[model samples]
Target: MQDLAIWYEGTALAGALRGSGHLYMVVNAAHILGIGLLLGAIIPLDLRLVGIIRSGPIGIVGPFLSRTAGVGLCIALLTGGSLLSVSASEYLRNDAFRWKMALLGLGMLTIAAQHGGGRWRRAVETGVPDPRTRFLAALSLMVWLSVLLSGRWIGFL
Candidate 1:
């Protein structure tokens, strides 16, 4: 792992990012914007899934928000990977960073599970969310919140 980190840190992209403060700042800002996009879409969609908001139809809103969140995930991964490459060695050693990665994996898995089957479609068509759907929604929210918190803790730790 250390060797891998060393190689990552030695990459031209990483070196350039670390050498240029402005580029680093731009990437960091883009990462934040991606997070905002993710939360803005997922939270409201999850709220609806959990029956917190009943005014809107799930069939219409679910797919839209999910797509938006997907885009955000792509942006985040791109920028976050760049940021990580800049400090791979230090980040690999940080407990908070490890926790963030774990939580992020779990969050992505939860999202996949939630959207993988006909469950979402059925919930939308019937206008009734099953217990499992509700459970997944709550789990997703918790997982994402933990991921965000751990990511923040990375800076402090």
Candidate 2:
């Protein structure tokens, strides 16, 4: 792992990012925008799924928000990879970074499980919240919030 990190640090992209202040700033800003998009989309959808906002129909809102959040996740991963390449060695050693990665993996799996479940499909088709769907929603909310927090912790730790 250390050797891999060393190779990453020696890569041209990493060198360029490390050498250029303006480029780094742009990448960082893009990363933040991606995160904002993700959180903005997911939180509202989660709220609806959890029955916090009962006015809007979940069937109508769920697909749209999920798609939007998917796009955000793609953007975040792209930018995050670039950022990580800029300081791979340090980040690989950071406990917060590790936690963030673990949470991200769990979050993705949770999403897959939620979408794969028959109950989720039933809820989507019937415009009703099943217990399983609600449970997944709550789990998603917690996982994503923890991911966000851990990502922030990477900087301080």
Candidate 3:
């Protein structure tokens, strides 16, 4: 796998990005900022969903938080893809990176599942209800935290 990664690193994609030092730095910064924004957006809503902010209307907070998360997701994807393009095959074999990617994927899917339909939106639009909403909140919290941890671990591993 290391040999394959080396080969891949020599390919046109990685080669194109190899000496782009400042660009890599910029991408790294953007990735960090994106992750920060994502967590900021989700954490409050997760708290609300868990019934901490039961008084407010769900429609107000949920959409705002969701949109903020969407923006973060877009930024993360753009910067992350740029970073990955410079070393795709190596990342593919990186266990921690693989887990980060998987968790990121799952977290996005979970968000989609929660807000994809009108009925689902309507149900939670007023703010999440008791039991189910709390469970969903916990899931959201866990997924994003895992993504963050695995992403950080990728650097060390």
Candidate 4:
């Protein structure tokens, strides 16, 4: 892993990204914006799930909102990968970055498990509220938020 990190640190792409230029800043800024979009889409839906919004039909709102959040998450991952490529070695060495990545993986797995479980399908079929679904949503929100915070702290750590 350390050897991989050293190679990434010395790669030509990394050097270009770290060069004295505006492109680097632009990429970094875009990544931050992407993260914001990701969080913006998911957080509110999570709130709704955790009993924060009782007016809407959970069956209708949950899937739609989750799909929107998924789109945002895709954008963030793409942009974040580009940004990480800029300084892969630094990020690979940064403990916060590693933790963030692990959390992200866990979050993704959790989402997959939730979707694959019978609860989502049952709720969609019956048009009924499921507390388990709400719990999954809340957990997803917390994981994503932690991923964001740990990502932000990577630079300093």
Candidate 5:
């Protein structure tokens, strides 16, 4: 991991970012925007799935919100890699960064499990969540919130 970090630090892109504070700031802002988009769409969708915000039909709401959050996830990944490259070695040493990565993997796997489940497909069509769907949704909320908090902890640590 340290070797990988050293290679990342030596990359041309990282060199450019390290040489320019303004560029780093812009990338950081873009990362934040991505986080905002992801959370903004996902939280409401999760709440709806778990029966917290039950006003709208999830059949109508779920797909749109999930796709929007996907876009955000892509953006965040691109910008976050850039941010990490700026100080890869330091980040690798941060326990918070490690936690964020693990939680992120779990969150992604949870999403895959939910989408791959027949219950999820049926719930989307019937506009009602089954037990499995609700459980996955609830788990998604917790995992994503932890990822967000862990990301913040990385900066502090």
Candidate 6:
């Protein structure tokens, strides 16, 4: 893993990111935009699912929010990989980075399982959420928030 990280740290992409004026900063901004898009869409959706916000129908906005969150996730992953490649070895050794990764994986798995589960589909179709769906929604909110916190903790650690 260290060898791979070291190799990534020397890649042309990493070198270019380091050498270019303002490119790294632009990338960082884009990463923040992605995170903002994701949380902005997801938090409300999750809140709705968990009965925290009771104004709208689930089916009315669920699909759009989910898709927007997906796009944000993709952008974040791509930019984040580039950012990591700039100092892959150091990040690899960071305990906070490891925790962030683990939490991210769990959050993704929760997304998949919740979306694929019959309860979620039924809830979307019927415009009503079950206990399990609500629980998963709450879980996703916590896990993703933890991911964000852990990522922030990475630099400090």
Full-model lDDT for every candidate: 0.91, 0.89, 0.78, 0.77, 0.91, 0.91
Query: Model 1, 2: alpha-carbon shift in Å?
Result: 1.3
Which regions in candidate 6 have their CA more than 4 angstroms from the true location? none
Measured on C-alpha atoms, candidate 2 has an lDDT of 0.89
Give the per-residue lDDT digits (tens) of candidate 3, residues 1-157. 6676667677765666677787678778998888888999998888777776666577777778878888988898888877786777778878999999899898987787666656447646544455655676778889999999998898787
lDDT by residue for model 1 (32-132), tens: 99988888899888899998888788888988988998888889989999999998999999999999999999999999899789897898788788999
Write the residue-wise lDDT of candidate 4 on 2-50 in tens digits.
7776776677767777784687787777777767766776787667667
TM, every model: 0.96, 0.94, 0.82, 0.81, 0.96, 0.96
What stretches of model 5 exceed 4 Å from their correct place? Answer: none
Residue-wise lDDT of candidate 6 within 1-157, one digit each (tens)?
9999999989999999989859999999999988888888889999999999998889888888888988889889999999998999999999999999999899899899888958877888888999888999999999989989999999898
Q: Output the better candidate (4/6) by lDDT.
A: 6
Off by over 4 Å in 2: none
Q: Which pairs in model 4 have colliding backbones?
A: none
Model 1: lDDT to the true structure: 0.91
lDDT of 6: 0.91
lDDT of 2 by residue, 1-157 (tens): 9899889889998988999999989988989888888888988888888898787777788888888888888889898999899889999999999999999999999889888958776777788878888898999999999999999999898
